[model samples]
Target: MPSLKDLRKRINSVKKTRQITSAMRMVAAAKLRRSQSDIIAARPYAIKTNEVLVSLVTRTNPDMHPLLRVREPKRGVVVVIASDRGLCGSFNQNLFRKAETFIKQNRDRYEDIQMVLIGKRAGDYFKRKNVAKRAVYTIGTPSYELASEICDDLIKGYVNAEYDELTIIFNEFRSALTQVMHVDRVLPVEPMEAEDDMMNVEYLYEPSEDILLEALLPLSLKVFMYRALLESAASEHGARMTAMESASKNAGEVIGKLEIKYNRARQSAITTELMEVVGGAEALKG
Candidate 1:
């Protein structure tokens, strides 16, 4: 039973909240657009890189390549890509759930597990587990430099036999309203399942095919990491946009309800004043 003053104040507070939520929705939309465009632009390069790597593998003995080498898992590392800030529904939560599944599934195989978190949310989610080796959290857009830095350490670890398996988990951007969680094996690059139609690719090389592979291996792995970062960034933007839009709609509904309540309270106050005046006049006449 709030008075008129309280009702008015509440209405004003809700209006302010609605304004903030609306603004957040707009900002998220803009960021989502930019992130989607970035993904589109990077698609060609990533595709081309994969095609080239596939062609090279077909021409050479993949067994000789270090990245193609596979062995029994003794230790494993998982790279997790999530958003630094959350206001984004269940994006981070879903990813963490998947990560937990991954860890549980691998626990029987790997003697030890390591975590490399790409965002703050991921780090926080696993902080209590004591598995995180490193975390890179950024406020700005995800960049190639960050991916490269992360992959560098991963590559070094694999080469040094620090870990026998490496994988990455991230949200894959599908559309404005859709995102699919992806778990990609980054080490011992999974063999191309089927032969490409253009398999017989011939490239004249000054160095031997093995030498070329040595150089391309690192580049290819870097591209894979970069692509994951890009996808995660785009997904984050999309989730944030969707979440903000929903919040804005909910706020609108709340404001509507508050408006109704305010009107009722104000009307009740006016009615009370009118009844008091009539009673006073009747009393004076008597």
Candidate 2:
């Protein structure tokens, strides 16, 4: 049993903590709203781009483009996206675990496996393990410039044949309370399924299909990378919001329990004092 004074102090401390968690919850909620909206707005554009890419790939020959060529992945790179901060429950841990599992499972197949970490948490984790090949540490919440910079590095690696294959690991935003980790192939663009009635459609290329593909392929890759970053930003906010809400609720419960304990302890102290006084008066009368 804790003393009444100690219990009171604990109650006060818990109240302060609850207030902080509640404030964080509200902030995360506000950020989540904006991030969710951005993700929603970007989805249609990403989907349409993929659809166009699918149509184009079906029409073009694999031999005509370098991107469409499928070769054995002797060397590969994995881009792991995680949050810079770690107050969001298991978001960073889950992503790191998934990335680690992926690396372990594929270690035997690739001669060289390199890591390109996008977030501070991921980079730090890999750096501690001495496993990351290269890391990009400065990505803001939702910046196009940051996305473009990462895309440029990844493109350079692929174009130079430094890696025959590239994969991206990220948390996909499903809902406010749900984020699913996914691994997406980022390079050596796979040929998409052909649509029916391909000859009926006419594509007028100004500088031939080869030139169009040369331009579109890199742009398409950048768009995909941007979409991934946006999704990750939204997911991070969602995770933080949910975690802070849970923390606030837990803090409230603890405060309630502490209040009950304080009241009981105070009552016990009062009862003991009353009994001591009555016994002393009786003894004097005797």
Instruction: Choose the strongest candidate by TM-score.
Output: 1
Candidate with best lDDT: 1
Which parts of model 1 have CA positions greater than 4 angstroms off? 132-139, 193-196, 199-201
Backbone collision count in every prediction? 0, 0
Write candidate 1's Cα lDDT for 169-248 as tens digits: 99999986899999988797887743656656467875877887788888888888888888888888788888888888
Return the TM-score for each candidate structure.
0.94, 0.93
lDDT per residue, candidate 2, 1-286, as tens digits? 8888899999999999989988988988898889878877877877777666666666677567766666689998999888887788888899999998998988998888889888888777878775747656646675666777877787777777778898999998898799999899867887767667544568686777667777778778878778788888888888988999899999999999999998999999999999999999999999
Off by over 4 Å in 2: 197-201
The TM-score obtained by model 1 is: 0.94
RMSD list, candidates in order: 1.7, 1.9
Model 1, position 8, has a per-residue lDDT of 79
TM-score of 2: 0.93
